[model samples]
Target: MDYEAGTYQKLPIKQYPARELGETAEGRYWRRFLSPATAKQAGAVNYLEFCPVRPYNLAVTSSTRVLVYDGATRSLHRTINRFKDKAYSASWRADGKLLVAGGQDGIVQLFDVGSRSLLRQFKAHKRPVHVARFDPGRMHVLSGGDDATVRWWDVSEGKQVSRWEGHSDYVRAAAVNPAAHGTWATGGYDHVCKVWDARSAQSVLSVDHGAPIEAVAFFPSGSVLVTAGGTQVRVWDLFGGGRELACLSNHQKTVTCVTVSPNAGPDSSAAPRLLTGALDGHLKASVREGVYELERFQVTHIQKYPGPILSLGLSGDAGLLAVGLADGTLTVRKHAKPRADPAKAGILVGRRSRRAPALTAATYRYFIRGQSSKAAAKDSVIAAERKAALATHDKFLRKFRYRDALDAALSTRRAEVVASVVEELAARGGLSSALSSRDAAGLGPLLDHMRRNINDPRHAPQLAALAHRLLDVYGGSEALTGMLPALTLLLERVELELRAQDGLTRVQGMLGPLLAASVGAC
Candidate 1:
């Protein structure tokens, strides 16, 4: 669980016998939950939302039903199937007591979340209703539809309160400003995002987004708005003359949905993130920044899906992100935050506590002088000792003293030293004498070294010679029986390599004559 800041642990790129790299903390943190739970819907999912209240239940709209799920456990809680046609959007009232959904039947239905019963139904649009959401006060609900109108309905009376009809095409996205009462925003296929007020009969402000708007959301501060459509996500300042702030083009396909993290606040360490899902099956999060006239937004995190992403939902605490794909796959992933380290925490607190005394040149020089002299002296002594020992070992081998050379090489356990000694002994025809003993102890190390290098084409011949001698000397001893399996496997691998080499040589000989004839013709 120990994580160092600014350090990225890389995952393996290919299969191996070691533990999977995905088992690391950073890997597990960003990994998908269990295999995606398949939603048994007959049609593609259109929208998903998590309740704003405690327990944070989830709602998914697909076909003619709105399915409710336990947010924490990801289990189906209930289903509302009263819609006569496909349902498009599902949203929750601020109090968490009511659930509302717009349907292809051109009607908006409200249900009691606790009782799971239809509480109110109102005919709102003449065509398919694409979106519905509750106002900030929960006293009225707004619904936008394919009829190209955004209408407000008084929830207490279950009657239409007002309607706006500026959009030339389907009205697909809408959101109410929680910080500013009776203020809201809507986006449509007409490629415009309009801010509205209940006190006015006309839109108070409008911004052209350059493409059909599929989804829109207001920053928690109610001072900015984000509109997503086509391949871009644009942020507009609501309070600053309605100027365009930043444009993000991270998605490769149409952005189908967008949501803001509920836990995002002005004092947060980083900007509250805007999560967008696209038709290309990518879900990405981008940090929201302050007013910058021509800044470009960058994606901070991305999660890929198996099908086009149709809906996205973020839990209130920002702990979970739920994605609904067009193929009816519901995947929920937990946010991975960097773990806190006590050492780092202590250092940070200490730095802010009080200033340390500044260093003077005299003290600095005195500290360096004492430490450097001792370190230099120790390093020289160790280096000279190592050089002397190596010289003595080489002298024994040069004298053709096979036992002394082999013993020195074995004690060091250095591959280069052992290989050189074995090669020399084999060339001088002293290999059998070097291994001629039933001591078994010395023979074991030699056999082990040979087994380790036997398959390497460069060392195969020398190792093979040494292995053959050891087998002849100690092949019948009980002590050597335990190592036979390893020795047999090693020899088989070397034989396979030798046969493959011989086959390749034959192939080259046959091709050389044909290549020469073709070259001469050319």
Candidate 2:
């Protein structure tokens, strides 16, 4: 009977400090929304909105026009270019039948989505109208403009319903409260945000946001308010008399837009998610309920853009995400379908094949019956099933060739492999034989490795012992005495390393007492 050779044993891998990984749930969730579709516009994309009704047609407002995209195909469905000057905001009604937008020409226009005809146009603002949104009842529209005023217009009457002129500067941001009728908020360049009731002309609530506010939003319950301004997104407790709940200052530049994800809930059982876009080219999703123990808000999702993000929008179902950038790029991401389990899919295919008619040569699957019948194993499974190939040094070690093993390890130019081989040779009492009869050229590689790795703490002791052994074997030989300069440099490196370690030790000792005192004080 013949015996197979034993497998070569691998060296013990050196251990290092383990690095901690952060939460991956958000990363995995956001990664599922793949297959991005992008469109180029004529100018900076300033606004993006998805229709609330099904098949969620997207509305993109750029320079002089608002382009409505077919939700199913993501193709341009309608182009409304009736503006005399640049258009600013394009808003969709709750029923998705009417579209309203404000323009730099100080005109607010409403259009019937089905007919693509202008139904009404209000021209009351003296300056550019920056924001226009429909009220919850769909009977009135609210608009804010650079004229430092917020106005409400009635669709049936085709005239202004009310005007509130409290803002000291340009009124750029406005949002209607979803849970409350006749309630809405407006933000302005005066760094103030005010909530108003349509029943009265006077403002009902007010808060100073400290910076020119760009965007504002109301929580689903209409109890919490969010404001985005210079690099900060603030959450306010409306029920608590407009007290600041959390000040999220994560962005490095001005936050241009903020919106609440439709999936967010009002109760604590489901944490609300806030999406903010900034001029720093980052879109961040933050959770109002704390994710970490001590953090007030946790930014869970982060996506980068090619240019400054000007506007962002999500569908009512949170299935589609749209981002508008300053560089005339509009990117839309649709949620991907979940993949079916492999075993279930295989079972379904097998059932179909068993009940089907005979395969024909004209069919594409007829020629490929054997090609994909057997599923390929995963990489981890394949690695577990296959044996590892031995290296040159490992092969020599199996044959009890210690000197050849050491030579092979040195030839590979890896300090860890060379150290492992030298340690093995020393254990087998073949270190002397491996170091014997080597000239200057043959020994250059070994000396160079020692010079490079003599100070590495992992292999320091082994290399030092080998260095002592080499000195003992070649100290008195005339052939090796000519290499004094190389040995001197090695000695200098060891001394320099020793000095560095001593300085670190002394500094640690000095810091120990200070750290202890600080801890005790805390």
Candidate 3:
């Protein structure tokens, strides 16, 4: 009967603890920065803007100079140092041929990007001009100043088009709506953000951001607005009477700038992502693709910088990320290309060609070149004769060696494996034989394992029975006197577990009537 195979109760699988975190596809995508390119400036970097066309040359504003950098190589392409005072916002036109920027001299200057020559200059503000941007039509430019006023300028005419004086404090940030031809937004030190239309004399919409507004931007659709101030970044619904949508407060200091990815529009396949820079020297990216809920507004990725970040810009194709720091340093990181798997890539000999010959099917060359790795077909039939290798204890159990099987399982130092072996031995009426061992060294490990797992409800019944059998077999054995201490400890543990179970049973009995009454009321 011992040699005959008997049923072994299936036990829950034990999971091994992982030593490291698993990286997800999205995590790898955002963490693709290679070695960064650094450049020293004469003063704190104030703004960074990327060209709207191919190559996407970056315009970096620092001191009185606006330096243009090659987008691909991140090398200095040209520098425009015509400003009499510190330059502020430097923006690019849609054609990429024209650039505009404001300065502390209270003047807005337009320049030819290729010639690095000033084309037009508009001096209308009484105080320092801090914010300037091109309108969507490319025919107009907007400028805001420390005098608490926003002004519109005609690029070709070289004159002020319209001026709006509404904010009670300095206007520091502005954004042109890409969807609406005349709609734009501005934020300032008075904690107010207002949206305006070029055709209207007054602002079309307004909202209180609850803190000094540092940055304002509109989604591509022009129906949503994003404002960063204090340590919070808030999203608002423009068409819903400026109803608040989501408020993200992940930064520890004042947020300095906020920008939307170029591909984050209604027509693009990628979800809308917001990138924000803060005085805490952190850059955070947040996604707004799922249901609009307060809890869903969470930061997905974070990048740290050495100094407080003042401005951030992503290229038109979202291939380059450039950051301006308060310490007069410019850091540019390019999107790393995904590496192709060497094992799956086809083996092409010599120079690469677009018109390469296709390989034939079912040949040895084709199978060796990654064709065998293709997924199996759903309709294909699978063989059923594959056998799994048995463990050390499993081999002993198959040979009707109960005591040896118990010893092999105990040697594994795994609670689940040991419990399974003991359950199998007891089912075959071999528990007494397996537990009839002599000497302290042989019995100490088994006693320790039982003592540790005796309180676990999953293996309690089997371990409790095994413990009782062990005591009955060795209760009067005088030769094993060295094991008295171990036996005493095991007995004390068993007694503690019994008392705990009794206390729980008594508590359950006392609460039975109360539970019944509550259920009846429900």
TM-score of 1: 0.59
How many backbone overlaps does candidate 1 show? 0
Candidate 2 lDDT score at position 322: 92
The better-scoring model by TM-score among 1 and 2 is 2
All models: lDDT? 0.77, 0.84, 0.83
Which ranges in model 1 have alpha carbons more than 4 Å from their true place? 1-38, 264-268, 289-294, 335-522
Model 2 clash pairs?
Answer: none
lDDT of 2 at 90: 95
Between prediction 1 and prediction 2, the one with superior lDDT is: 2
TM-score of each: 0.59, 0.64, 0.75
- Poorest 10 consecutive residues by lDDT, candidate 1: 5-14
Off by over 4 Å in 2: 1-18, 264-271, 291-295, 340-522
Model 3 stretches with alpha carbons more than 4 Å out: 1-21, 264-270, 289-295, 340-384, 397-522
Model 3, residue pairs in steric clash:
none
Query: In angstroms, how far off is 480's CA in candidate 3?
Result: 10
